[model samples]
Target: MQKTGLLFGSFNPIHIGHLALANYVLEYAPFDEVWFVVSPQNPLKNSEDLAPAQHRLAMTNLAINAEPRFKSSDIEFSMPVPSYTLNTLQRLNELHPTHDFSLIIGSDNLINIDRWHNFRTLLQEHSLLVYPRPEYPIEKAVIALPKSVNVLNAPMLDISSTLIRKGLKEKKNLRFLLPAGVYDYILQHRLYQQKKE
Candidate 1:
């Protein structure tokens, strides 16, 4: 009867903000371990802009190394294209019956849940823990959600992968936003420093 909250994301560089959110869920939410499911491809995101899955996974591992309660998972790497949430959840359910999976998402994402494939089924089958995004209203967002979904007040850091990438492209310093070694890893590999020509 172990409960594990899945924090699914591309984790392009595994920033401090991402680690903070996952750590917050482990402390505040009813979960034993918080797994960062490194999605290979997201339906709403452009894969061309994504770093290689291995690099992203490596950064995630580096970022969560100090936290015993946090883990990095490459579960979605082997999954189908367009990487739908319903598919990933169903696969995880079959593979690990011992661990019950809940979803940790942001309020802004909840606003677009209707666009996700079989999103209602996802809600009925598992728990959803949502944290706030800067401009998204939790009160208004929760109104359309079901009772199983719980809203969390995790600090909404204005950090985003897109912003980080933009900073890199412009040759701006953004080393403080990432985890201890993640910034080093990104520098070593020269990821997202400029858009691929």
Candidate 2:
């Protein structure tokens, strides 16, 4: 059976860190392709701060287009708000039963898994591939992880969408932090410069 790693996030604007991390996961982990699942509504976050789902999906596609193993997923666009991983995973299984899917997430997200809806059931069934995140220590997470969970040693950068958006609002340099095409698209569309009113 083909294996696919699902990396779920808003991808407000796909950046270099996101692409780099996805590449790292594909190279070091056991998976055929890494799908960047762009969430339309993340329950833990305020949707007002998110870019439009189509724009976010487009940016993600631009960032990963050159890499065959990387894909942009808009699966959550038609799904209900405050998207639940369990529901999405269930739907994905129904849609593609032939492929085995693993959840790829950041170490920080793993720490808060208990807060996710039906997290326990999701944990029991699916394998988790975790990467390090800034300010979120991994050692404690490892102590309590399940047998199927894998903590990757991929390079952890302090980059975040918040800081990137702040830079854009302030007209600061963000050349290296974003992919060229993704950055260009953001610039062309004038995204993340001001909150949507």
Candidate 3:
């Protein structure tokens, strides 16, 4: 059976760090394909500064188009607002019963997983692959997580979408932070450009 790994997140902008992690997972993990499930809205985050769902999805696609193992999914976009991981996983399991589905998350998010909706059910149902986040320790999380969890010691990326957005607002060079096409798209669309007085 084919194994599918879901890398769900509010990829406000698909940065190089995100791509790097996905690539590393694909190479090292048993997963056959890694889907980037672009969340329309994260339950715990403020959406005010978030780029539109379509725009984020488009950027993700552009960034991963060259890779056969990387796929961009808009699964959360079709779902209701404030998409929860449990619901998404349940639905995906039903939709693709033949393939096995596992959840991919960062250590930082795992720290707050207990607060998510039906988080207990989420842990029981799917295998989790948790990668390290900058300034966050995975060992602590590994101790707390159930036997279904796999801790990946992939290269930690200090870059984040928030920092990239801030760089754009400040008119800083974001050449290597994101894909060239994605960077160009942001420039062409004037995304994150602060209004002048």
Q: What is the TM-score of each candidate against the true structure?
A: 0.94, 0.93, 0.95
Runs in model 3 deviating more than 4 A are 195-197
lDDT of 2 by residue, 25-125 (tens): 78788688989999988899977668888998888888888889888778888889879999999999999888899999998988888788988788888
lDDT of each: 0.87, 0.85, 0.86
Candidates 1 and 2, the one with greater lDDT: 1
- How much RMSD separates candidate 2 from the native structure? 1.8
Give candidates' CA RMSD values in order: 1.5, 1.8, 1.6
Most TM-score-accurate candidate = 3
- Pairs with steric clashes in candidate 1: none
Candidate 3, 85-167: lDDT as tens digits: 89988888888888788888999988878788988888887899999887777755533678888988788889989999999
Order the numbered candidates by TM-score, best leading: 3, 1, 2
User: For model 3, what is the C-alpha lDDT against the true structure?
Assistant: 0.86
